[model samples]
Target: MTMQVRGSKLAARLTASMAALALLGTGAVALAQNWSTTVVASDNGHKVGNPKAKTKLVEFMSYTCSHCADFAREGDAAIKLAYLPKGDVSYEIRHLLRDPFDLTAALLTQCGDPKKFMGNHNAIILSQEDWFEKGRKTTRAQQARWQFGSNGARRQAIASDLGFYELMENRGYTRAQLDKCLIDEAKANALAEASQADVEKYGLTGTPSFVMNGALLDGVHNWAALRPVLDKQR
Candidate 1:
């Protein structure tokens, strides 16, 4: 009877040790892999997550639109935390250049390398309230420079008056580099044309729109609505 009891106690200890080892192995696997930090750039935008993800989500957002900013605030945390780490889904925020304000912000976001796009993007979008208010207070004379003159001159005027220059400067960009990006007629025109194409292609009615798996996710604008659709795809 004593021998049987001792053997039972030893078996229990071994079983517990094996389970703990299994759990540690699983944790190591989880810690070793997370694809959320990856980002790739396309001509008109930056993409995040696995390049060949089964589910691709595209957001058509304009810097001038408040709703787009709201999405950035809400959707970013949810998607980056929950979905992007999985490596099965991808996200891209495509530009919708509505006006010079939109174009200026987009140019600033696209200023540095591809890796800088999202950080620059959030910087501009999150601070829209301040610069937009400044724009509203500007005199007609001040606003005129944004609309009239050469393309580079008009872009420069808008950037200066709206505080975009200061925003990018805070993001570690030099004045000369920001100016070069802001005045690139070719890049600006390409952005404009791409936005136009997306608008027509999607039959989009507003600034905050979505495309999922190459199909437009109709009537889904905010994060709340977007969540269910992404879950279903997963």
Candidate 2:
């Protein structure tokens, strides 16, 4: 009798484990299916094109990436011409962990009025080549080797390279805010956590990637290639 009861309990435990696994798998599928182009943030966050447009496009970019800059300068013109002006699509840009300097630049961009978000985005993209000429490269591997390796040193370097740190000085953020943005333990943890979430959720592995109304588009292709799809959605 004792042996039979133990076997029954063991079978029940196995069944419970299998049920839990099934639920986990179902949750992951739901998350993937629900992956959205919209980033719900207070204060409008960083957006472009039409705010109330029917379609939503989200861009994952890094300020330090030349390819991303190319997309911003060359590709954006066509994007703006088509989706932005038509009130058919709303655009959003989010940052993934490309490098530490990218974080510093992001902090600077987010420092001022959220109204000028795109302005700051353009400023960084436009200056990409110039900054590279002056020996500031914003590549993923390069950033990891240099910036994340030493947060304090990288912060000071960016304070000199970009006026972002200084701009926030008068904004009532003590040294703590500046350092917190650069080395804030929580923010750093959050970036890492969010990055992993983005990767698994979106199957994204690089920058300059886009999701146009839930359609995933990756690469450096021109807007000519993008219009047909955008048009169909319209």
Residue-wise C-alpha lDDT for candidate 2, range 5-29, written one tens digit per residue: 9999999999999999999999887
Give per-model TM-scores.
0.87, 0.62
Worst 10 residues of 2 by lDDT: 35-44
The prediction achieving the highest TM-score against the true structure is: 1
Native-to-model Cα distance after best TM-score fit, residue 90 in candidate 2, in Å: 0.4
Score candidate 1 by lDDT.
0.89
Summed over model 2, clashes come to 0
* Candidate with best lDDT: 1
Q: Compared with the true structure, what per-residue lDDT tens digits does model 1 show for residues 58-80?
A: 99999999999899999987898
> How far is 144's C-alpha from truth in model 1 (Å)?
1.3
The lDDT values for all models are 0.89, 0.64
